[model samples]
Target chain A: MYVAVKGGERAIDNAHAWLAEDRRGDTTVAELSVPQIREQLALAVNRVMAEGSLYDPDLAALAIKQARGDLIEAVFLIRAYRTTLPRFGTSIPVDTARMRVDRRISATFKDLPGGQILGPTFDYTHRLLDFKLAAEGAPLAPTPQAAPDMAPVPHVTALLDRDELIEATPDTGEAPPDLTRQPLELPANRALRLQALARADEGFILSLAYSTQRGYGRTHAFVGELRIGAVAVELEIPELGFAITIGEMTLTECETVNQFKGSRTEPPQFTRGYGLVLGQCERKSIAMSLVDRALRWKELGEDFTGAPAQDEEFVLSHADNVQATGFLEHIKLPHYVDFQAELELVRRLRAEALAQTQPSPRAAAE
Target chain B: MSIMDRQNWMGLLARARPADLAALLPDLPQSQWLRPPEVGAVMVQGRTGGSGAPFHLGEITVTRCSLQLTCGTVGHAHVQGRDRDHAHRAALVDALMQTGAAADLQARILAPLARIETDARAARAGRAQATKVDFFTLVRGEDA
Candidate 1:
């Protein structure tokens, strides 16, 4: 007997029940509070905020909790919700130069105008596990810092330009490309490059950066400066006819100094790769610089080697994790109808092929 | 194939909402489609026979707007009775579902809209049936 399988209401209900049970886990351990997740797992929240493109910490935290600590899933949740809410209006471009510094450092200079302040970084820590954390409660030392409000951070790049060694950074306030609105076309402006870097995958960005360092498409990068801080996002109310501080966003900015390998006719003008993104994502910024350089191969008079990292269309399109996951997982949906059609066609083709190659039983009598 | 019932239709409609929905408005999706918006006809109740004899439906006029997103999402939005937001929201849901918010969307937006639509439809049917009544009269005897 031929039997056809169809998943009805009962199957769906049971599956959902199983899934909920799986999500909850064994009842022995205490369930994590949303606040606790937000406060403690802050970097995760930051990443979610950056990629989710919404600046709400509480909502991101809630999404993280609902996603069971899957940061990507949390980001997806925020993004989905963010799009649905009517876009009232876009805020004015944030000024990174005026950012209230939290963790600021300059790699190009040992001693600059603004001293390097390593606020809170896991860079120097050993990978050894702490047994105390496993046993539940543990005492932690209070954070140390008088680090009050200070003067504006005169960028490390400015220090280099004081001698007139590089080209002056142009202040073109022209509206940069919105990648969300339009398709990513070749020969992108600086705006498009930065946007791609902001949402790019951590590991993938890191690898492309590593490749550049290894001379696959090297751009001789010395992190001219890396700064992480908070900048106020200002919105101009049409009724009031004046701009006001609506909210602030935590951001990481990176500017890399590359050797001015100029063309035959052109002057030896030094260029820089710059990136700015929501939250403290120095790694992403730096990787962004390398990728940024790779994408600007044509502009920089570098040869097109057809690298995946160098491919503008490929990188910009696939940089989004949410898009990548959805298309990949869509295959899980039932394809039985299509599969059956293919099966019948293939069977018929094979039968015809066999018939052509072999003699029929009645052929000898004929 | 199975019988078309209220429960089956409702189940299909409810899938529009997720169990844990988000609070986002879906934007119009884009596509790489070649076709531009052309004048299309909308289905309307038309009496081929009289209303008493049970007639069929006819077609009305509608305009559809479609565009392809950078992501190659061929979004189609048609105003039923000319409601642009309706088509736009449908296309937006189609785009966002491809993203991470599929679950939240189902719970919040889709579920609520489905519920509202179902309720409104039921209300309309009730109002229509209120006026429906059967009447009869007996003939007078002429012998008197």
Candidate 2:
């Protein structure tokens, strides 16, 4: 019974005009430039890029401006823009092992090679507001140190792999299914699941990951290692007969070691859950790893405890904020005709019920 | 030059700042567009456990173009971001690298860009190096 009604052309236009004015906010103040948003509000840009599944900082900044700082709306804008571009090809999987390590740390091991570098993090910063930053002057510069000729840091999991204490991650040598190109299929492979979780909404995944720690779907996970840095992205050039570096991007990676008992066919070994995300999104990456482990219960021969995180369809279907928001927001649109139909039906049913309960005029006279 | 050498120079050109590349190579040799510079995207992939099966992480903007020099040396360039001029300059550099001008271009263009990249990397390394933890244990009075 859904019927289209058209008449708000002028009203809609006026609304949009007002929205634009409000988005600018207080004409007395200076305007916000795209570069300012890109550089100063970097974490917001990172979140938009990660969730939007597009990594153009400029575009993300522009979206943020247009959306008036509504991050999910910014993500929606980026996603819309991304679908219009022609995809050239897929890049060769980036080598994180050779990444220029900016921040590398391990919670499981006290002493590990490539000793823990904190890099530029807010982990130790006090939560109190800095009123000085509210002023326009530049903040104090960070202390510089002599550059060390550092060796390539190896993955912390390599140590556990040496003695077969941790399960080995063998190269599958297969092209993974592109979730963007295909509809989400249930019983998703690890590769497909990881792809979904990488671009999944940060807040949604964070909560799901948090649930696991609260014993809903406990995996007894430990953060094996977390590293964030720039890595070169290489692509195979068919004419050149070899791969060449196209560019580099900042990536945050987390590997979680989860507890596992020996199954009937396999020996006892620590299981691993992996997460890799665009930019320096450490929180999202760590959360992704935990949720990733919880979802692996079936493959690891663990019990299906009916936890929300363990349900693949449930997690993947609802993880996308853009999709969730669109569906949720559509209800605000005019459902007038549908509601009217329901209203008439209910009234008719009510009258019929009353007629059955009470006698008609002719019956009463008889 | 060997394929390895070509790779090194092409990578440098691809990653160079557009303004930097433009400043270095002001005059370009006559060339015809085999494929005009077009902006597109490349789906970047990452592995499952940093070294396992591959999975799609995200897409990055990449501009690509192909061109042929007057001497019949054809070259292709694919660089990240949506700068058509950057891609064109990169392709020109690629074509020039195969010609008699290869050594001159390397000295004038590639060397400076490489230095800039190296300096940036060093600066980033220095900042991270400052934060490397040096752990120590306190000696107990009784044990001492």
Candidate 3:
């Protein structure tokens, strides 16, 4: 009698203990503290916070450490922890207009209200690797800039709106659809688009944005404004009958203006693309804005040409790295039982074909 | 002082994460309502009659609570067969029935199942370590 091997539980336990040991490494070696990770590896932490959609850099850092420096795994960890958390209430939508702008820039207009603040960017850096920095990178000297004490920078979109050139973004007060609760349908709103871009896989969104530039679904985009800074997250307490500032997050907001050739009915308005993220990730924001525009084909009176870029359902559905990685890696699980059934079916089919070519004694009698 | 670093990535998974599925654009059935089960059960592996080796040969009873929210959100709190905190979970679900809280709960409750599964496996491994044996016997010269 053939017996199935059954030690799944034991095998799992042993593997976990081993993993714990591996995570810690040698017992004699000093343990890495969470603070060390948070401060030293701030950028990694920022990416996790951005992608994980949770603003806690400390948690993100801890997650990164526990994940063995695997960002995707860290994102997964954050996602799981976030589920069990006891949420009191929803906060009001953050106003990027009133954001205490640290870094603000516009590619569309150089001499706009907010001239340009490059903030911290690697755009113009040489591509060559610095081997000296491999040992210990020198501390970057902070660039000092005179504060624009007069007032915060006005939005680049505001400039277009000033002239009635671009379409106005209405705050209809209608709550945006929560993509988490509802399954994504074909036609999505601007809110869903923004959310998708915010939590989208950085690389996937980048590639999608790159595709637009390569004429896949060319939408000439000029970065209207990109701003990064901390914004208060105010939550309403029904008991208190007031909103309280619970926390704050550093966010990156990108608004893009595309060339619009109006259709028969609508005016020739400058189409808009918007992207907002958890941290200072300009590329993610720019890409997000482009994808956001690409997704607006239905709203824009544009034809659905069956192109991959134009397919909102396909793009949004496969936009997450966590979901992508999970599903992609889940294939590695044991499928021997299923394989055995398939093997039996194929054998039966081959046997039947062979019998038909040269009838066996039993078959001939039948 | 929350931070994100490469190390933080792994740490994040050390717990659990389900919100990542937002990328998949999962079609979750809309139902904010919750109903604590009058008589519920979970498929928990019952220990073997003895402690020789805890195999997956048997299963035990685990009663759970279920509550249905007004928005049709179903909240289930399964404990070690019976738990009082099911009400807490139900209340959480009721709260989640609100406009935006549903997203939080889906990530907090459902996504951590994988990590819990991993932890359970680890526990079993800890137990198996004791019973791990290397068997051998001295042979008599008579055979030679």
Candidate 4:
């Protein structure tokens, strides 16, 4: 006998109202404005923009506020909103080589053409909670520094390429598949895999990259270069007979030089794994490069050892935390009918077993 | 001019000093908005390293404005970030530049901005040159 539980509709409505109230908290303190989130909580906005694949700071800030600072949820809001908008035409590739770099470092060389710059980073910051931030005080302004020279800083990989030590990346002229538009298929190409890793959940990618470092996929890597800066984005307007610089964005680009074994036709060479992420997401970008290197095993003629990072289908499918979370949490809803059917089957089986185990009273007398 | 050169000029014009532009044209033609200045985003794409199949890098905020002069020349300006006034001024200049009326003001308005941009670039280059390094290793006796 199964009785369906009723009155969930009203309960849910009340819960939602309570949730709204909770989100408001004490209205005595001033409510957080979108500009404050956009400006003050910039890193959160950056993460949402990066993961959501939309670059609007105001919307991201609003999403952050609506999601109560849960960055993943904020990303989800932005992602949902993005689907409603139409995409304009694609712009020409940004020139990072000409980037007015804020922070640039190369591990392969002790000193490079443009010297290493250690910009604003939390690397050496003490993790102490600042009580001053609790009480409202005007934030201190940053001292301005002179702009970086307008010159192309050669990539560290270019030095290795001179001796044919690194693999050359040639332009294929074919449009790479957009993972957002198409269903992810198995044995995806490099471009598609890169796209997946780009907007893939940062924490998920980090763990996979960490797994590789622990000898799961084991591609020894050196940080060839890590650059954080503003790059110009140019767009072509055929009607205008020229392309124009539309905007600039802050990006973190990481390149990993990994060891590759020689094959029949090719000599042993250091292969490259590239990652370019939005904002100053150093850890995510570095992790993305490691995962990228691990995924290149097939193309580089290395045998797959069934590692998590090496599995294309696994990484690409599970990388989206939104999908993973929804599927994992959906089991909490409505299973009463299913359980009732199982209950009936079990009761019938128990009765049959009891009848078989003990003889009836009439049979025993006979 | 090559597209690259023209782009450079447009960039200069977009960032030109407002006072200088105003001084160049004391009395400007009244222009009506075709598309008023609005903030939006432009998705930025990039190659792996200057040469590879294109990949999505990220998005940057942009303000685009379009205006038409009374003489019917329409011009558009799409500049980076959220400066509505800059976008509008650039659009006006673009409209004026397309018309025959721009002949006298082009040099008067743009030359100073161009010089400033060039000087800024040179100064930046000089500062970076101060940090330029040349690395060399000493050979040990045994190796030699």
Which candidate gets the maximum TM-score versus the true structure?
2
Residue A185 of candidate 2: its Cα lDDT? Answer: 94
Each candidate structure's TM-score, on Cα atoms with residue i matched to residue i, is 0.67, 0.96, 0.67, 0.82
Q: How big is the positional error of residue B39 in model 2, measured in Å on the Cα after superposition?
A: 1.1
Model 4: pairs clashing at backbone N, Cα or C within 3 Å: none
Candidate 3 lDDT, tens digit per residue, A41-63?
87788778777766666688899
- Grade the docking of candidate 2: medium
Error of 3 at B118 (Å): 47
Q: lDDT value for candidate 4?
A: 0.77
lDDT of 2 by residue, A1-366 (tens): 445678999999999999999999999999999999999999999999999998888899999999999999999999999999999899999999999999999999878988888888999999899888988877688677756645788999988899888998988898899988999998899988999999999999999999999998999989999999989989998877888888888899999999967877878999998989998899999999999999999887899899999999999999999999999999999888888889999999999999999999999999
RMSD of 4: 5.0
User: How badly does each model clash, as a count of residue pairs?
Assistant: 15, 0, 59, 0
TM-score of model 4 (CA atoms):
0.82
Better of 3 and 4 by lDDT: 4
DockQ of 1: 0.01
How much native contact recovery, as a fraction, does model 4 achieve? 0.42
Off by over 4 Å in 4: A1-13, A130-148, A334-366, B1-6, B9-43, B58-66, B79-90, B100-144
| Prediction 1 global C-alpha lDDT | 0.60
Q: Supply candidate 4's per-residue lDDT for A331.
A: 83
In terms of DockQ, the best-performing candidate is 2
Instruction: After the best TM-score superposition of candidate 4, give how far the Cα of residue A225 lies from its true spot, in angstroms.
Output: 0.7
Worst 10 residues of 2 chain A by lDDT: A142-151
Q: Report the candidate with higher DockQ, 2 versus 4.
A: 2
Residue A73's lDDT within candidate 4 is 85
